[model samples]
Target: MSSPATTPTAARTPRKAALASWIGSALEYYDFAVYGTAAALVLNHLFFPTETSPGAAILFAMGTVGVAYVVRPLGALVMGPLADRFGRKFVLMLTLFMIGGATFAVGCLPTYDQVGMLAPALLVLCRVVQGLSAAGEQASAISMSLEHADEDRRAYTTSWTLQGTQFGTLLATAVFIPFTLLPEEALFSWGWRVPFWLSAVVVVVAYLIRRHLEEPPAFQEARHEVPAGQPVSPLSVLLRHHRAAVARIAAAAMINTVNVVFTVWSLSFATSVVGLDRATMLWVSVLANAVALFVIPAVALLADRVGRKPVFLAGVLGPAVMMYPYLAAVHAGNWPLIFLFGAIMSGCLYSMANSIWPSFYAEMLPLPVRVTGLALGTQIGFAVSGGFAPVLASAVAGPAGDNWLGVAVFVTIACLISGGAALTATETAQKSLDEIDALHSSRTEAAELQALGTGQEPAAGRGAEEPAASGAGR
Candidate 1:
């Protein structure tokens, strides 16, 4: 049995896991976000034949970008259960390879002018692979870190996973800024592909770091206790005992609309609609993400102290209120105002919720179902919010489209939905990893007892009864 003497060592393990998660996530998402940047500015021009309708072409390019999200949940269904049953480390390593290999291949694909329809088809295939990898990446990384974390500091540790994503976005945009400044003739031909090709370097580095990571203690305990052949199915476990948490996470994930709007829709809106220079918008994204790097960890620390809900609530609501002003500033065509808005909205305001989500979401479910619950819930919600955001933004701002107000309203509604979802979740800030599972178990049992009293069958296949008052702190 694990003992109290092991606590200090276990605490240090999460730090190492956090470091690994940060580096791996940074490398993985760099490949993903750079593709989005290229889709907005370069892919439409290169992958599709020139047509009379440039706007329609851009929309088509973005649709291809969104196609990845459609594949994400499918990937999650396969990988999530595997992560839960096998280990976080195994799934993470596989995800990195998939994303890295697909991204590198995309860099080398022939253009539409050369390969005809085959170019876009190849692009979609690579994107599906990337999406599959990404589907398991975030949840598995957070689970690895959070499961290793000292209970009191779980939010802080898991938040670093999110910080890594922002770092990746910042790094990708920073790399692209210099490339975007190249002459147009050069940019479309090869400049954009440089970022994709750089994935080779990121993949090698991430692979080296992730190879050494150990499985989390929670998973180890689950492995030992559960019978070898009677392993719990992640989907069945979630559907029976943790369905409410999954529902709440899915709803809260709609808050990703804020990200889609800021990253994808805004990139297109600024470049295509507002006539801002592509490099300028890229720089704005870089600064905002740079700010997020700091803000995410800091807010995560705050959540550790004050509670995840309040920090998350502020994060959820902040975007709703700020969207109008931010877009108005963008509409005014002032670079300084746009910079300030981007930094505050994405960097400071959104970072609050963004930072805490990795921990907050993981805490809601037990260890056995954690990866599946998170992957399925967040990806499904993200697909709805993120996949359609660019398309919706395009429709809202039709030809001669300058309606920033309508776009702002759309973003605010997404924020409100996520905020309400956050408010409905139980506060788990003070709970330890072991206690989280137990607490959920107890609450589940209580609900079942109430149902039994009313002559209803207790929820089927609920886990064996949790011992009462068996709490453990970080």
Candidate 2:
């Protein structure tokens, strides 16, 4: 039950872990964001050509964007358990290779004109591989960051995971901008593939950073806790002991729909439907995410002080209210309002939630199931809300594809679900992992006692008696 080699008190490397997570996450999301941008701007024509009706082409292209999400939950079921059982660093390295390889392959695929139905089929297969790799990326990264962090600064440290994502989105959009401005013949011929091909560079950089990283001390210690040859089943533990935690996390993560709608749907709506300049519309994303690079860390620091729920719920509701006007500005072809609302809604407001969820959700579970629970729950939610958001928004926008009100309403409803779910969560800012684990254990014991009609005290009731953080909300 105890091993000298895998001590729980091993040196913590918060800064190193955070840096590794940031680079790996940036590379993973860069690949993902590249596909989303291509789906919106370029793939509709090259891979999904409905010569008689552009709407069919748009739907097909956006549907491919959702394809990865569809498989992410399935991937999570496999990768999550592997990370929890093997180690965070191992899973992270494996996922990095899978995502990088699949993304680079996207650049080399044949277009619809060259390969007929085979083009779209191959594209979907590559997207499925990407989704599988991404399934465990964020969860494993969050676990690594949280385990390595100082007790007082988990939120700030974990925020780097999402900050990297913002940077990835910015880089992806910025790279795609010149492609949009290319001469139509050249643009369609080869310009768009350049961004996907560039994924190779980031893969090498991220792998170099992640490979040298050590497994978190917490994970290593947990590995030794079990008797040798009696492997831990993280899925069984997750489903049996943490169903409510998983449900709440899944519901709250629906907030990511704001990002999908903003980054992907809005881009296509502005350029393809509303006749906006493609480069200008792309710049809106590039600028908004550029601002998010600063905004995410700032808001995360605030969450560390004020508690995660308040900052995150503010983000959820702010975007819900702002979605209407943001889409309205786009539909009206008003440049100033578009940029203003876009930056405020996504760059500032959405970053608050994005910045906090990694720390907040990870704190809801114990060490053994942390990665598994986070990956499965968040991936399922993402598949439904984020993966399908662009396709759903496009479908709801009426026959003319300009029903901005319907899209706004859809996003608002997703926010309501997210906010409502977040309201039910315990505020976990500034809590140490041990304390949070104790709290969850206490709750589980209490629930089990109730089910058994025993009415006994929980063994770990100390965590339940203490207030989470000064002024932390329910």
Candidate 3:
């Protein structure tokens, strides 16, 4: 029997761990959503000069939003190995500080008046850092939460990390409402800066909570039992063994495009093309997200009972269907229809993927390579779809205006692709950590057998029969 000293105190604090993950994720996404809000409402007017047409200026500001997504996959590539090898907690804290500091610096940047061409350039630099910070935040938090959770309860626990994201959106949007009420001069001059500046304070508190966290027992055990031969890097193992799994994950992650469409492009569309009031559009976001606060957790509980795929597919299908009515309402400038369709599309429907993707995406890979695989696949996919999607949606809106039908079709097809890819994945809801982790277990067992032949007690212990290939069906 193991001694009390060997008992994993980290796994014992699942609730605390989940709470910490929730708060940190909330703060991280709050910073992101704040940037998005700024890009939509004020960025064109503030950072970039108005000598450019408003249309061209908005396009450039929106493109800056995509810049972060562009860097996210690179961030994942750089940070995933560190999290996999070092421990999730340290990396989580590092990402938090980087994101918070970068966001705070954004508030401090000069406008084109003071800095000329250099102003937008500086803003892009800060956004790139924020994007890199974001790349690892969700993946690391989910990995730690998953490792600390009970086998049956993993989905429910991991769902909280995503729940935090909804709260962040709510908070970010709420902060902007009062600011939007300001006169155009005041709103652009300083009102938008408050939310970004507040990120620093939240980061300090979240960092304190996260710094105390210990690595989960599963990760600690794997780290404890290094193989007898030369150690392999997680990157090499991921490429050689889990190539197909990563591709599938990236494919399924196309769902992020749907999210970007709802949050970013749709807002820009309603305001610019549809001529909806800025406050009206902002309230739609706040209310829909408020409803989603409850919706996301409930959907996740159901996922724990049913399966990740069904819940996520329902999420994908609902929004794909609703994407039509919601945009139609925006085109009509009908407030009630806009709120009704918008709430369901964003709050109830889109949230299905929001609640479940943390657990669903993480479960696709075995533990040893889980962080890198999840980060690489999801961030890269998000980069291609979510990152540049707003620019695409804007172009699709076309020179004729409010041609949202094209953009709506773009979003629907993306959802169909992600949902179809999800169908090909295993139903991991009922599986244990060890069962979900097949490839690593097989290799460990093979190493243990080799150790036993040398008359050394098996250092890593035995595992299930090895898969014929790393990407073979679980």
Which digits, one per residue and each the tens of the lDDT, describe model 1 over residues 1-474?
A: 235454333224878889888987897778878998899889998888777888877987988887888899998888888887678999999988899999999999999889998998999999999988897988899999998888788888998888888888778877888998999999988998899999899888888878878788656543443232233356665677677888899899988888888877787777887898977887787788889888988888889999999999899889888888888887778898899988999889988989988988888877667898999889988888877776787788767668878888888888888988888888999876666766665543542422221223334654245342221111
Clashes of 2: 0
Q: Report lDDT (CA) for all predictions.
A: 0.80, 0.83, 0.80
Q: What's the CA error at residue 123 for candidate 2, in Å? A: 2.9
In order of listing, the candidates' clash counts read: 0, 0, 0
Off by over 4 Å in 2: 3-8, 39-61, 110-120, 179-192, 265-278, 387-409, 442-474
**Candidate 1 regions with alpha-carbon error over 4 angstroms:** 1-12, 45-60, 112-116, 180-191, 225-228, 266-278, 391-400, 442-474
Pairs with steric clashes in candidate 3:
none
In candidate 3, stretches whose alpha carbon ends up further than 4 angstroms from where it belongs are 1-10, 40-60, 110-118, 180-191, 226-230, 391-399, 402-406, 439-474
Candidate 1, pairs of clashing residues:
none
Better of 1 and 2 by lDDT: 2
Per-residue CA lDDT of candidate 3, range 1-474, in tens? 234466444354678778888988899889888998899889898888787487888989988987887889899987887787677887898898889999999999999889898999999999899888787887899988887877777887888998898899788877877888999999888989988999988888897888778888766655544235444466766786677778888888888887788777888888887788977787888888888889988888899899999999999888888999898988889999999998998899888888898898898877666788889998878877866677788888898658888988988998999999999888999887766775333553443322221222333433334332322111
- Inter-residue clash pairs, candidate 2: none
TM-score of model 2 (CA atoms):
0.85
Error of 1 at 348 (Å): 0.5
Better of 2 and 3 by lDDT: 2
